[model samples]
Target: MPELPEVETTKTSLLSLLEQTVLNVEVRQSSLRWPIPDDIQKLRGQKLRKLTRRSKYILAEFEHDSMLWHLGMSGSFRLCDHYTELRKHDHLIIQFEDIELRYHDPRRFGCILWLDQNSQSKLIDTLGPEPLSEAFNAEYLFQKFKKKNVAAKVAIMDNHIVVGVGNIYATESLFNLGIHPAQPASSLSFQQIEQLVVEVKRILKQAIDLGGSTLRDYSNAMGENGYFQQTLLAYGRAGEMCVNCETTLENLKLGQRASVFCPECQPLKKVKIAPQKAIKGSKA
Candidate 1:
């Protein structure tokens, strides 16, 4: 699935649509993760004012409302000339005066939905703080981790705890901070949490700068593959020598997602807890 960086790159690539009026919309397949809004024709005359992203969803802002777009498992958008040939999975097309935007998705897990200008979506409203935002600092993560006993990898990937830390980025971030992916979330110290915050932001920003990881079907609007996959130190380097210490990296399933780490670099260390003392006046 397209993660935060990929979604951001896609949004950036569509800037040309700004201030462009929609001439027509063609929905070759209305059935996606959710059905394309039946009344989408209401956008025919609306001009696209801006584009923004939250987590992995792209918001195409217009005069009266916005459209939320998701690049699901294998979804992508492409800019094309009006006479360009449509491929098999070309599910949606929006025509403009000079160009057309096409959406292609093999898995059909992506969505395009309409949102009223003043209305808030429960889906967007419930998402946790953006990982790169000031609200997701080490202090914020430490508080959230204190109440969860799940693996650190699982905790970081939780959309309710922090948005856009997908499996690839989670594994890489943990490895970068020398934290084992399977370590319990509550085991982290303030120092470790601080390091984790730094590494997550660093890795995510680097990925976005490189156009995101093109491990599979991900691409920007111009159909360009991301270069970050070429620089991956962990995540899919299983059984390979670690670049830092030359130890063979291992792979395992954490929360049903593939996780990779260097054993020597990220040794698992359980936090020691003091035994509870019996209360003076209460029964033992």
Candidate 2:
């Protein structure tokens, strides 16, 4: 699946479409994760005004309406000449005078939908702050984790807590801080949460700078592979020597996702706090 960085990279590559008039809209396969809305044809003759990303979704703002695009599990977008041969999975195409933009998905799990310029979907409305935004600071994360006992890794991956921390990035962030993936959410000290917030932002910026990770079918909108995978220190390194301590890295399942970590580096330690006693003069 295309995570935040990959989606952001795709969004950047697609900036070429801005201010370009749409000459045609083709729906070779309307059946995707969500059906390609018949109204998508309305984009024909309209100008693409802007492009932006929210979480893993891409928002294409046309002159009068907009499109909410999600690059599902195996989806990708590429630009090719108008006369280029279409691949078997090129489900949708938007043709301009000079080139064509195609959406391809082997699994057909992506989506292409049209929306009124002023309308909003529950998907976008419900997402938490962007991980890179200042609103997702440590104080915000600490409040969300209070009284929650879920594994720290699972909590961070929650979209309501912070958008776009997918399995890969979440695993990488925790490993960077030596925080055990299975540690209780509420047990994390304030300092740990602060460091986690910083690490998440730093790692995400680094990933985006490196063009995102090309795992499986993920690629930039230009069909170029990302080089971020080369810098991975923990993810997909199970049973391999830890780059920091030479100890063999270990793998375990958390929230049904594979989590890789060094047993010596990320030990699960839950702090126990003794209950406070009531003061004699205080109301019982």
Candidate 3:
């Protein structure tokens, strides 16, 4: 899935479409995460006024309403001239006077939805604060972590706690802070939480500056792969030497997601295990 940086890069790549009128809207495949709204045809002749992103969703504002786009797993958008040939997975195409915007998703998990200017979406309404926003500072995260016993990694990855801190960024952020991925959320002190918040913002901003991690199928609207993957420290470097301590990095499953960490750098408090009762005469 395209995370915050990828979405932001896509938004930046789409500035050319601003103020351009939609000459036509074509949906070669109407079925996606949600069906392409039948009313999308109503966008024909409407001018695209602006393009912005909230979390992982792209918001395209027009004269009367806005459209929300999500680049699900393996989804991407490309801008091409009208003469460019379409590929197998180019599901939707919006034509402008001189260029075209094509949405391609081999996995069909992305969505394009129409939103009225005055209304809000249930999907967008419940999301937590944007990670880059002032609202997501260390003090704010500390308060939110109060009484939450979930793992720190899971807590940060929760969309309700903070948006756009996905698995890759979350793992890298925790590793940067020298916090064990499995450490309980409420166990973090105020100072640790502050460090975490800073590292999260730093990692995300750096990734955005580099376009984003192109681990798989991610690309900007220009079809260019992000270079941030080259600088990654821990996300996918399991069994490799840790940059800080030179210890072999270890991998584990946390909440079913792969987490990599350096045991020497991120040692956790040992949890006590109860002694097991001996079964009567077998092994003895």
**Per-residue lDDT of candidate 2, residues 203-250 (tens digit):** 999999999998786888788999888989999999999998999999
Q: What lDDT score is found at residue 15 in candidate 2?
A: 90
lDDT (Cα, 0-100) at 162 in candidate 2? 90
Q: Which stretches of candidate 3 lie over 4 Å from their true place?
A: 117-119, 270-284
- The residue-by-residue lDDT of candidate 1 on 1-284, one tens digit each, is 89999999999999999999999999999999999999888889989998999888898888887899988899999999988889999999999878999999999999999864332456688799999999999999999998777899999999999999998899888888899998999989989999999999999999999999898878888989899888888989999999999999999898889999999999989676667888899975
TM-score of every prediction relative to native: 0.93, 0.93, 0.93
lDDT over C-alpha atoms for residue 55 of model 3: 77
Q: lDDT values of the candidates?
A: 0.91, 0.90, 0.90
Order of all candidates by TM-score, from best down to worst? 1, 2, 3
lDDT of 2 at 35: 88
Which pairs of residues have clashing backbones in candidate 3? none
lDDT of 3 by residue, 98-158 (tens): 8999999999999998865332557788799999999999899999997677889999999
Supply the global lDDT for candidate 3: 0.90
Steric overlap count per candidate = 0, 0, 0
